[model samples]
Target: MNNPAAPPSLLPANRRIVLSGEDALRILREIEFLLMSLNNIGRHYYPDGDDDGADAERRAQYCAETTRFIDAQQATTRLALMRRILSAQFDTTLGDDEMDDIERAVAALPLWRVPGQ
Candidate 1:
């Protein structure tokens, strides 16, 4: 499996690759979809159906695997965003002071709380 800690290498070479607020919103949406898929798959594989012992065990393992993949995806996305944001400022069309201001703003923001706990 690919390491989620590693930044994606296929990112555009341009240092100032610009992203909009829309892009940030998209990232959240993508994460939600992946998480939902993982949960749905787990529930399907381990439905409270037949009482076969072997099937039960297989489903349990599958659920764990699905959860791991979801976690890894979230980790990878965060790392990727950090790299992108740092690089974005350097390459921005915005002036140096403007870019610095943005960096400060982002830094000042509190960590996001997942909805509904």
Candidate 2:
């Protein structure tokens, strides 16, 4: 696993990598696909049909932990990309109140991935 506090982008910020709108959208799509793939893989490994004994219980716990680890990695990558995008000033006219509301709404979200994605 990479450092939790450090991003894994190959391009350092000093390289002046400005994210276009399309780049940001593509990054979002990649995050969505990663989450779906993780969920599907976990189910494939620990399906309900396999849950009956102590070994099954241990596998279930391991699967849950793996899901959390993947989620955190995806979040770190996406958030780092987001920092680059927002730092470049994609849009600059919103009032402070609007920004605050947006922050609050995003903070309230339970999961970053869209449903059924």
Candidate 3:
């Protein structure tokens, strides 16, 4: 089966896909869910309560790293959702200028290192 997430250019030109208001709303809801899930993961990484013997510096670092990671992921997801919405609504792929803006935004995001990586 063809991948639903495939970019418009990857799909057959003869095939036209249109997203209704309901479809777009669903995508927005999915983004909200994704944000919540990422937030939960961040909380898991640094939960409230006792330090569990972890040093304050290490805990602060973890908090910073996790927040950066989640922010990056959220930004990327929002960009992808914007592209998808534009593609479905306009029946066109993003132009180079628009894509360049997205690339710049993503590149400006602070880098995050995974724990132990």
Residue-wise C-alpha lDDT for candidate 1, range 46-111, written one tens digit per residue:
576443544667867886787687586675676577566545544234443544334544544556
Model 2 segments more than 4 A misplaced: 1-25, 48-61, 64-75, 82-101, 107-117
Q: Could you say which candidate leads in TM-score?
A: 2
lDDT for each residue of candidate 3 in 37-81, tens digit (9 for 90 to 100): 766655665576345866888678768876786686676676677
The digit string of per-residue lDDT tens for model 2 on 17-84 reads 46677877877776676677667666666677454543866787767777686687676676577666
lDDT of 3 at 25: 85
TM-score of candidate 3 against the unseen true structure: 0.34
TM-score of each: 0.33, 0.39, 0.34
lDDT of 3 at 55: 82
Query: Lowest-lDDT window of 10 residues in candidate 3?
Result: 2-11
- Which model is ahead, 1 or 2, in terms of TM-score? 2
Error in Å for residue 20 of model 2: 4.4
Clashing pairs in 1: 16-91
Query: Which pairs clash in model 2?
Result: none
